[model samples]
Target chain A: MKKAFLSTGLLLITILILPLFISPFLVYLSTEILVFAIFAMSLGLIMGFGGMPSLGHCALFGLGAYTVAILSEYTANIYLLLGAAILISLCFSIVTGYIAIRNKGVFFLMITLAFTQVLFLITSRMKFWGGNDGYSASVTANFGFGEITSNMGLFYMMGFFFVLSYFLLKLFVNAPAGKVLKGMMENEGRMIALGYNPKTYKMIAYLIAGSMAGLAGGLYIYKTQFVSPALFSVHMGAEVMIMVFIGGLGTVFGPALGAGAFVFLQNYISTMTDRWPLILGLLFIAIVLLKRGGILHLIQFVTTFGLKLFKPSRSRNAPVDKQVKGKEQAS
Target chain B: MIELKEVHSYYGHSHILHGVNLKVNKGQCVALLGRNGAGKTTTIHSIAGLVVPKEGAIAFKDKELIGKTPNHISKAGVGLVPQGRRVFSSLTVKENLLIAERKSTSSEKQWTIEEIYQLFPILKEREENMGNELSGGQQQMLAIGRALLLNPDFLLMDEPSEGLAPVIIEQIKNIILDVKKTGLSMLIVEQNIDLACCVADEVIILNKGEVVWQGLPNELLHNEELLKVHLGV
Candidate 1:
């Protein structure tokens, strides 16, 4: 517990001071990472905890982006835009989740993919929303404080939301409802026997994930000052899935770390070579083969290995060792 | 407190249960005895709403349960301890128990975490151990403890002694008796006649998706002809 606190504190301090040492472009990239991190984390909740795999999570993200874009044209009231983004995403998820959640396994995946495709088609064809060219309208609202005209101000705003989202999501997964969702994932029959409607819990998870994704989408538009039909594309959805897989599915902070790594790699590699995706694909394959539990598991393995190497006697006196000893004595 | 009237369940063109009827009165233990493929598990599944019946009515405390979902059935005060001890393999023993914990609506005493620890001391000892880390007997105890945490008026146990050793089966028998003393109605499906007779107030023998015999435990013990023909004991 102490170690977790220390690491969290260290991470926060590092992120806070990142812009001070880095270039303006890197700050912008950092904001992008945070946005995608929230997106990946939302997907992770449903896929990892609720055992409901969705291929159209980008629909929620896109919906939020479009809501913010359209709303910003009339009024730049940040709160209104954010609220509308979340509300729109919630409505979309409820409608889509009601239909998609009924199907299990591959069917669920297919249904979600179909829904996203439908949204993409609508967004691209609708001329009122700028059609295929998308919308790049400037905002007037000052996120409740003042005009966030500067990149640093925008970075701080993104950081604030990132921290808030992280804590909220962490609280959610550790709550009683979250535990039931995990139980549902493990054994839906058992959860039903225990008086938990799996569908209700699943729908709740879907809503939470959708809202979080919506928040990310709102932030995405604020950071880029644009909204495009590409936001709802299948490729973007696949990218978030890859990020979740690279981070670790169930671990709360894994997706954030995954998004950071993915954004950094994508940015760095794209600058050097057009074959960056080939390298990214190889890296994903390696991670999957070597560390099935993702980067978090890999980090854990390394840390434990380092600890054992540094303090062999401490490892011998570990609680697990004591348990084995107690069992041997009993037998 | 639970009754099934001519419950006819099907599994995609195959009629698994053919008008099966059973009952467990308040504070009573009724054992459904049958050989493999005799629809014993199907009967329990039907009660739990995992296998919805095609026809006939199931009522728990006079409320129709046929059209209700499994979770709704559970909330209506019916708990199921499924076959294979389907405890959450990824969760710890404590987590498994806590997730299933629900307050009893009736005036009956609630089953607290401490009480469960008292009943299964091993679980308390391995509170942090993952479900998959436990032994078969331990998993069965966890499964029973999980169901008890729901604080249900009726419990359905399917093959509690299917894969356990004789010693563990004996322990399970005592546990069932203790649970019965708590005034919870139970419908236990079992192939082991000894375990069935040990805790049951009545015995039901099923063959080919139909109840062929129903009698007192002592009556079943004395009727060797009935036992040999139906159970092949």
Candidate 2:
């Protein structure tokens, strides 16, 4: 636990010092990555812990963004806009999750996808929501304190929220409730036998994941000042899922690292070629084929390898010996 | 404390349990013995609410449990050590125990982790081990420990000796007896006649989803005709 804390602290310090050395464009990109990190981490909650692989997670994301954009026209209260967005997205998840969670595996995936597609059509086709063109928030981003005109200022604000969200999610994952979700994922039948309603826990996870995603969406619109049907696109939904997998399926902060890698790759590759999606696809194939688990597992392997090189070889075999002894004793 | 009256259950079109009636009075242990496909598991599942009965009433402390979900049934103080010791494979032994820990009422004796460790010292030794990493006997002990942590008033054990060696089966039999000493009513389903007769207060035999004979363990063991005709022993 202390090691995790130290590493997280080190990473945060790096993020703090990063903008000073980077260009303004990179600062903005970092802010975007932070926002998507929040989004991906939220999806990770359900996918990794609850083991409910959702295809339409972006529905909640889009709902959050749309809620903020539409609400911005009425009031400039950033708190109200973000809060309403979160609450609305949470409600949307409750409705969708209630129906979607009834089905398992492929059926669940299809239902979520269908729900998002319906929402995408409605937002894009309707005149009130700006149709395909989309709606825009105010250019000057102000959050009660003052206008965040500089890229650094926005990056700092996003970075703060990113850290906050990460800690909040970490707390939830460590809580007894989260442990139950992990158990459910491992064996729903066993969890049921243990006196836990699987659907109830799934819905709880869905609510938290949806609201957090909504918060990311709210932050997203503040950064881009634009909300469009593109936010709810099938591509967006699938991309976030990919982000979760690329980071690490079940780790708390892996999704954030994944988001950074994904956003960075997308931005970097797009600059060189128009067919960036094809390149990205190939890159993903390579990662899946070679890495097997995700970027997080690869990093873990590297770190352990580094440690093994430094430490005596005898210590490495200790756990294995213990496990073998345990087996013998058990038998 | 638990009663099942004329419980008929089905699996799709094929009916499994045919109006099975059984009861486990307070502090009593009933062993359900049957051949394979005789609906022994179906009976256990029906009581645990894993298999919802089509037409009949299952009452725990006189409350209807037929329409209740498995979780609801479990929460109502009925615990299940399911068939094949369905321990959560990804979870550690400690986690499996902790997940099922429910606070007992003031009237009931609370079963703690310490007590569980005392009961199964090997579990304490393998506390950090994952469920899948354990041997069959260890897994069975974990399964029992998990149910005990629920502080359940009644337990439904389905084939606790399903895939264990003779020595392990002997250990499981002793564990069952130990648990029975706690005054928790149990309905144990087993094909192992010796284990069943050893621990159970009364032995009930099922044939084709129907209760064929119900008597003392010694009586059943003594009756060669009933054993040969129904159990193929």
Candidate 3:
């Protein structure tokens, strides 16, 4: 546990120093990655832990973006705009989640997608909200300390929220309630027998995930100063889902690593070719076919393998030690 | 302290339980014996609120439980050791126990993790192991322990000795007896007649969802004609 904290601290320090040496464009890219990392992690909370695999996660994200964009015209208070965004998205999740949670498996997925499509149509065709051209908020976010107009400032703010979201989710996942959620995922029947309302837990997870996704959306608008129908698009929803899978399905930090890897690869590849999505699709298929529990599991495997190599004699004696331990316990 | 009167449950359109009625007195262990598709499990499910009965009254300590959700039934001091063990494969042995842990409402003894560990020492030894890693008998023990942690006044156990060796069944029989000693009333559904007769204070036989016979365990063992007709023993 101490080792985990130390490593996390080191990683944070590295990220903190990275922008100092990198270009402004890279800082902008990093900000985008952090925002999506928050987005993907929110999706991960429900999909991985709550066993609610949603395809309309970007609905909350888009709603958050749109809330901030529209609310900024009336008020420059960052908290109020962002708070409104989170609140609106939470309300959206409650309504949709109430209906969607009644169905399981494919039905749940289809219902969430159907709701996202509803939001997509409203945003895309409304001329009052800029229609297909999308709404661009020209106002700067005031933090009381100063206005954040630069990419570097936005990157640091996102970095802070990214770390906060990771720890918040980690705390939740390790708690007794988190264990119940996982148990519910494995055997809903058993969980019911054990006195846990499966729907209640699933709804709680969905609400939190939606709010977090909205927060990510609120953060996202700062990076682009733009809100488009594309934010609520099915394509964006699919992309976040792909990020969650490619990074790791069940791990807390896996989604962030996934978001980072996805954003970097997409940006790099799209500059070279128009068919970047095809390549991304192929990569996703390859990862799923490999079935190695995503990049996080692969990394874990490598590190453990390296450790085993360093202590070859200990590895050989491990089974013998286990047997002896078993005998001792039996006695 | 648990009573079901004319409880009729169904799966979609096909009815599985037809007007079932039974009662378990306070601090008594009643064994429900029957053949396959005899609605033994459905009876247990009905009480646990897993299979909400379409008709009839189920009262636990005089409180109606027919319309309540499974969790609501569970929280109302009704614990269930469902058929197939139903242990969460993803969680560890300790996690399975901890998830269901609750304080007893009454002045009766509250079952704790330490007490459960004492009851099943093998569970204590394998605390770090996942639920799926345990043997069949160990899983059964874990299932019983998990339900006990709910601190329930009444327990509904389904097929406690469904898939086990003779020795393991004997062990499970003793475990059920020990639980019975705690003054927790239990209505156990069992296929193994011997195990049922060994543990139960009273025996009830169900055939086609109706109570075909109800008597003492000894009387059940003595009545070969009744057993051959209803249970095919």
Candidate 4:
């Protein structure tokens, strides 16, 4: 627990100090990474913890963005936009989750994918929302603070949301409902026999994940200043899944690390090489083939290796050793 | 009390249970004995609502339970210790027990975590261990402890002694007897005739999904020829 707190503190301190040393473009990139990290974390909640693999997760994210885009036209209230985003995304998840969760495994994936595709088609064809070109978000909502027209201000706002969503998700995942989710994932039949309606728990997970995704979507629109039908694309959904897998599926902070790596690769690697996707695919294959636990496993391996090297006599520290071992097994 | 009349169930195109009739009165322990593939597990599944019967009237305390979902049936006071001791493999022993813990609405005393630990002291010792880390006997004990935590009025246990050492089986037999003394009704499916006869107030034999014989446990013990023909013991 001490180690977790220390690491989180160190990470926040680093992120908090980062923009000062970096360029304006890097700050913008950091904001984008933070937003995507939130998105990835949302997907991890369901796919990793709830054991419900969704292919159309982007539907919620897209709906949230569209909500922000459409609402900004009428009002500049950030609270209203965020509220509408969450409400719309939650409602969409309830309908989609009902249909998607009825089917398990690959069928569930397909149903979710189908839902997003339908949404994508609608968004692309609807000229009121600017069709494929999409709509620009011209809102001046201050989020109860000063105007956030500056890049640094927006970056800080994104950072604030990232921290807020991360802690809230962590709390939810450690709650009794989270334990139920883990049990349901391990054995749905056993959960049923134990008098827990598996569907209800699954739906709850979907709603939480969807709402988080909606929040991310709202942030994404603010960062980009635009909302396009492309946000609801199947390719975008697949990319988020890749981000989750690349970071680590079940680990809370893994997805954030994954989003950072993914966005970094997309932004920097693509600039340096034309075959950046090929490089990304190779890296993904390597992770899947060697470390199924994703980047979290790599980080854990390095930390443990460093600890062992520094303290050969640490066997006497049984509690710390056991805690590390427990984390190792969980990943 | 629980009763199943003319329960016919199917697994896809294959018929698994055919007109199976059984009853367990309040405070009674009824053991369902049959050879492998005699549909003993199927009958237990039907009662637990894991397998809904195509044709039957299953009543638990006069309330029809044939079409209810497994969770609904469980909430209605039926606890199931499933075949192969299917405890959640990833969760800790304490978590496994606590996950199934529900408040008992009955006037009877509730089963607390402390009470469970007392009932299975070995479980208390290994409460922090993951479910899959335990030995088969320990897993069986944990599975039973988990079911007991639900504070059910009735329990449907499938093949509790299927895989265990003789010493462990003896321990299980004693545990079943202790549970029976608490006045909770049970329908246990067992291949071990000795264990079945030891704790069961009555025994029912199944042959190809149909109840071929129902009698006292001593009657089953005495009918060696009947056992040889049906159970091939």
Which candidate gets the maximum DockQ versus the true structure?
Answer: 3
Please give, for residues A173-262, the per-residue lDDT of candidate 1 as tens digits.
Answer: 777888889888887877877888788889999999999999899888888888888988989888888898899887778888788889
Identify the runs in model 1 with alpha carbons over 4 angstroms from their true place.
A1-11, A20-25, A313-331
Ranking of predictions according to DockQ: 3, 2, 1, 4
lDDT of 2: 0.89
lDDT of 3 by residue, A1-331 (tens): 3544665677678779989898888898999999999999999999888888889999999999999999989998999988998999999999999999888888888899999999999999989889889999965777799998788888888898888888778777777888899998888887887788888888988998999999999988888889999987889989998899998998888888889889999999999999998898888898889854787887888899999778758435679878788779989
Model no. 2, DockQ: 0.79
Model 4 C-alpha lDDT per residue in residues A1-331, reported as the tens digit of each score: 3444565677677778889899999898988999999999999999998888888899999999999989888888899899999999999999999888888899999999999999999999999879999888776549676888887888888888887777777777766788799888988988998899988889998999999999899878887779898888988999999999999988778999899999989999999999998999998999999998899988998899998888857446668879789779989
Work out the TM-score per prediction.
0.92, 0.91, 0.92, 0.91
Best by TM-score: 1
> Per-residue lDDT of B1-233 in model 2, one digit per residue for the tens?
98889999999988998899998999999999989999999988888888888999988998999899888888888989988898888778998898899986621768999999999999999998999999999999999999999999998898999999999999999999988888989999999999999999999999999999999999999999999999998
The residue-level lDDT of candidate 1 at A132 comes to 97
Model 2, A1-331: lDDT tens digits are 4544665677679789999899989998999999999999999999999888888999999999888888888887878888998999999999999998888888888899999999999999988778999987774567778988888998998898888788788877766788899998888887997889989989999999999999999888888989889887889989998888888888888888889999999999999999988987887788788886689998999999999788866535569878788779989
Residue B133 local lDDT, model 2:
98
TM-score, chain B, each candidate: 0.98, 0.98, 0.98, 0.98
Off by over 4 Å in 3: A1-11, A17-25, A139-142, A314-331
Clashing pairs in 4: none
The DockQ values of the predictions, listed in order, are 0.79, 0.79, 0.88, 0.79
Interface RMSD of 4: 0.8
